[model samples]
Target: MFTPSYHDGVIQHLITDVSEDDFNVAVGGQVEIIGWLYQYYNTEPKDRAFKKKKYLESDIPAVTQLFTPDWIVKYMVENSLGRYWIDVLQAKEDPRSSREIAEDFGWQYFMPEAEQSDQISVQTNADSLSQADIEDVTLIDAAMGSGHILIYAFEVFMQIYEREGYSRRDAAKLIVQKNIYGLDIDTRAFQLAYFSLMMKARGANRRFLTLDIRPNVFDVPESGELTSADFQELLQSEDEAKQLDYLLDQFRYGNEYGSLIQLDKSVDWSMITRISNQELDEGQLSLSSIVLTESQDKLREICAVGKILSRQFTIGAMNPPYMGSGKMDSILGKYVKKHFPNSKSDLFAVFMERLRSLTDTNGYYAMITQHAWMFLSSFEKLRSVLKADTLINMAHLGTRAFEEIGGEVVQSTTFVFKHQTIANYIGTYERLVNFDSQQKKEQAYLAAVKNTDVDYLYRTNQANFAKIPGMPIAYWASANLIHDFEVGTRMDELVDAKVGLQTGDNSKFLRIWYEVDNKKISFRSVNLSESVKSQKKWFPCNKGGAYRKWFGNYDYVINWKNDGHEIKNFNWPNGKQRSVVRNPSYYFREAITWSDITSGSFSLRYREPGSIHDHKGMSAFSKDHELLIMILAILNTPVGDHIFKILNPTVSLEVGNFKSFPVIKNKTIEDKSFNISRKLVQYCKEDWNTFETSWDFTSHPLLTHIADDNLSHCRSPVG
Candidate 1:
């Protein structure tokens, strides 16, 4: 018997004189010790020491009050029991069973001890196995949290045994003690596993005291008496001190220590012996720290379990923790790298390694994990590895699977892998479907295959699986004709002249232009182009209003003039000296249009809307002006839409205010009614031809030509 202390929001400790009933009462209510342990393990640490720290609960005392949701347990039991368990353990099965026949006929097989026996027996038909034989198949939930899957498996096994003429009580007891095995990082979950199995065994036989007899098959003491002293002893060793120092150094350099450790001192030594004593007496305590320590220790324990299963059982199942790379601390990262290098590279990668290590060459492994590893670039290496090793029978469950956890609307997929010679499973083909709140949307366009040929099938509803081909891609011209021209030109030949100017103080100058009243615009305006009338209007800020004062103090004004002469005229303020000017300047700005073809590299102009025209013989007035209008009009037409579709397809083109070209029905050419100018016609025809050829679109060339021609000619004035 023990007296329990409930303080500090926890059951701190239990004094002597507490009964087993009291122990169960103290730790087995709705607010049980396991629930408290889970709450503690999951609670976010406020201080730096445990801010991002993760703790496991295996080290704490066993308390069977924790249980996983029943539905999940049922699913795991149905899908991962019998041969599934044997597959996990790599054990051999009877040759006369359906498993052997199934394996021979291209179905996935699971058999434990196949390798050790050097012989495998596979069943091909489901009806071949008798209820007695089915009951002989043993299973284990290697990392059973709260006994969900384990208990579910036990119930299933009991059903098979009862159908074989065995009494429910006898069969259930056998199922609990001999048929099912469970391990967990949380001692509370382990206890739950133990109790849940017992509860399942008792079933409707709860009234029989003989059936309620306690089994000693699985016993995890209240305080973890067996491991507490050993762990504490390990903590006191000089080797542990050295290891701690190494770990601390690694953490410091790796930038992980600030949140994992509080001080250099060792763990509380006095607590170990006390914890052990409490365990023997079935004492009660908060057990948070102990649980965390045990959880960490379970990483090794899980590995040990893997080793044991490799030699013992045939089938196994687990819902392993889903941890992202962002959560890995330096110490854990180091441990993962040292122990599980392949998994250390990526989360999914580690899972693959663990699965391969645990399952036999002829076994199956299945799990539900983050789907990002399927398509994200960071996991490409892991993907390559998985593709090389096994075929995946996958079903993607969209966002709804985790809606309660505040999880993102991300896609998740389940992968089922069987180690066999067959290339594929012989069931229904799988498809991807989005489970919306009320209905499901089929995402058939996203389907793809690896090495196997997949048939495309469609389903009108979510109940069935169907395959669909990849979506059709639409491509078009990505840039203006200027881009086509510049693709092969030299830099010197392309650029004609260059100018350099500074705002003196860009921030201050911009402030004067932006922060001042509307009237100040006249003062801040500077003459940048020729013509006194143009200059006066251009530098409207200096002409008269409040803004005139803002520009009055400027030392110089920079302006350019087209003198209609060999050398264009550039003027600087009277007091200022000119900067260095070059002959055959390296860059010049010119207007361009849809009709005037240019190099593809000129796509850069799509952003700036100005090009450095290098054609030597074209008339500047005729070409530049027409180019400007045509460019602006083309930008408004579907031709421009096509261009944008090709270059920046992901970006929406509906942004910003811009001038548009109106649709003109017809334009007369000579005596005939031609829809557009001859030049515009040719340009439109060429643009359409380019789009058709580029995208491999099958359309009437003439119609596409006419539509583009009419579209190009339609133009509206730019403000």
Candidate 2:
């Protein structure tokens, strides 16, 4: 009835120009198609947002859009929503476990709890809770990107309602109107979710498209030019006025904050819904009653959003955005820092806490987030909060969990947790980190599920994580390893691991040894004062280089002339000093240093006296030189490699990581280690001296004596 010719021509062009296959996919009746469409549609914007040196708050949806794989969606929904119904049934009459019931319901992705032995430390009361009426059970996805999770949840809810004596058609409509709820900040994401949910319901009920059933999915809208005074004239009570005011102020940034906005849980949204939609008789007709009756006004939008955020869900699931605090703009960073202080390190972590709070007590929250929070020290407080909840299951997808994003930069883990704590609850975990691709990871997870004794599957009590320093979720660690953490001497007690300086402008103050005047460089300065006394412009520096062990990576020289006056005085226009001189006394103290942000095995190399280190090249020192070598030797062992990865599985390792490393004081082993370390260092140094990249390099071994092997001793290998 209302059509504009100009927009109609654009629509005609869209219909005529697009490929038939694309149109077929739109009508494919598969909800997953929407996620794929969104993935490809926002390709350019996502790339642009990521590639820009400077990003804006507007680019959050673009950069964080990830099309969750169908298998992962099934896994998340089958475990959370499916488990909810299963638990309900199990708690009522059926003696079957939640996993067994899920199997009977044909939830293929639901993993059975691993077999725990009698020798286990503690027991749990996992099945002693009551569930809400199946009709009242609801699932909400706060970060419902393209509604992938919500669609799968709809399928689960439909199955539950159907088995509970309702017809498929009625179940579909009920699932849309009552069961599945979703919220997203981005307009495009919200639109896709709305359309996807309708299509999903339409598949189960053929005539659903002609019906007036509205899915409980709303796009978060900002409250623009909205004020409490606008509704004050109609509000009958002061509490209503305050509620309206709170809604307005909370939703001012609703478009940016979305479901993270903590709404007044005390507000009766169901009562508000009834009052707003009630048919007004002639006698009951009044301005105050019409205050919340405006369907198309900002009040309605605010009320709709408030209704979703005001109540906790029986099951909350999402694949929240994965942006580090470093990438966030000041507005988002500070807001998260202020509210979700414990999980302020990343967007996913922040949303984790948000979702947990939005879940009902004794309910469940399921999500797939970057695995950094599972181990990073920055999330210590978050881990502490999680200690109160019981972990149900986990699928550790280390990397390549998403088809769009590749490499080790964004490792992911999917998990489901009960909102209540269960003492010594044994959580099942699928270790898919070794599986390189999505297909391999999925297959590995299923394989681990099928075989209880599979090497990839691990069952552990979450309380054991707290026994270690920083409380890393090292599910694969042995009981002995955990005990070692409690009994063994911490590495911090054995040696002083110090983070070195930041020259700020490495290009200005640093150079390859070959890039500087040889006469101006000092190879041996015992202290910072000696550098100024010797009048050398450049001193050997240990800015972390590529992975190497025992010795070498000594290729750069730093300008430390006159006690680094030029570097220390380097400042911005705001008079903020650019350089950071940390642990200045340890500059030339002969420590073992390791490179930061490494992808390979952890390796600590020996650094000789007279050289300073960089922030990336963290240094560990001991007053006894032999003891330092022994410590380096022990830290470089295969045992150390395993322990270190458990400590901080992410790429970045720092001084703090080493401080928690478990060490035992065994004199015999220490002496043997010291001798072995001494020999290894000598051999590594000799080999390093022959390499062209090494500062000690004199000449190539081939050029030393290739002409006459019998007389090779004459050149002394020139190393």
lDDT of 1 by residue, 1-719 (tens): 22354542233343233334433422233213333445345333212223434422321112212233333333334444544533322233443543443344222222111111112123322233322255446564544556555655555666556655888767766676566665544544556656655655555356434655553223211222223233443354665545434332323321121111122334332332333233322346547556644634532332233223334334445554445444565554665566564346544456555554555444455555545554333444454455433332444443444433333333444445544433222322234333452123122312322212334321111111111001001111113332432342321232221222222332322232233443322332122222232422111111011111001111111222221111132234673433322221212223221111222211211111111112211111122333333333334345544433332222111111011111222223221322223245445434433443322234445555566657544433555
Model 1 score (lDDT): 0.36
Misplaced by over 4 Å in model 1 are 1-73, 82-136, 204-312, 345-349, 384-392, 407-410, 424-432, 437-719
How well does each candidate superpose onto the true structure, as a TM-score? 0.41, 0.90
**Cα deviation in Å at residue 383, candidate 2?**
0.9
| Model 1 deviation from native, Cα RMSD in Å | 18.5
Best by lDDT: 2
Lowest-scoring 10 consecutive residues by lDDT in candidate 1?
Answer: 463-472
Every candidate's lDDT:
0.36, 0.83
TM-score of candidate 2 on Cα atoms, chains taken together: 0.90
lDDT of 2: 0.83
